[model samples]
Target: MISSFLLPLLLWSIERILKRKQFGWFIVIVTLSLVNNFYFAYYQLLTGLIYFLLELFFVINTIFYQEKVQSNVLSLPHYWH
Candidate 1:
């Protein structure tokens, strides 16, 4: 039930993080994942742990990829129009 509500917000955060390179959106995603872990922990500890780990992995990879992309862009020579 609550997951449904959070899904869109999570997607939005991912989009914003990728598009704007804002660290705040990444923090929001982490917060949301933690909240989800707590919410599911009451019912199933193993499931919650698995979900949290997966989310963490995804967020970390996204951050690393964003950093790599930004570095690559900065290294490229720019031409004045």
Candidate 2:
């Protein structure tokens, strides 16, 4: 039961690390969680990983779509180069 609290924190830290490049919180949480309870932490790590993968997918999708839009319709003047 107590181990459940780590899930949210681990997920949040993963998000922060991805969005803000903030590794300190993630590192601390991972270290503590692993040291305190490797068994439960493993599940937490898996959930965090899934979240990270989803975020990466969306981010990549958005970037590609944006580039496609810009390339197809938004032509820049030659002088801008």
| Tens digit per residue, CA lDDT, model 1, 3-37 | 55554555556556555766686566557656777
Give the lDDT of residue 49 in candidate 1.
Answer: 45
C-alpha lDDT of candidate 2 relative to the true structure: 0.86
lDDT of 2 at 22: 92
**Candidate that scores best on lDDT:** 2
For model 1, what is the C-alpha lDDT against the true structure?
A: 0.61
TM-score of each: 0.44, 0.79
* Alpha carbon deviation, residue 38, candidate 2 (Å): 1.3
Q: In model 1, what lDDT does residue 33 have? A: 56
User: For residues 1-81, could you state the per-residue lDDT of candidate 2 as single tens digits?
Assistant: 557777888888988988899999888888888888998888888888899999999999999999998886666555468
For model 1 the local lDDT of residue 61 reads 96
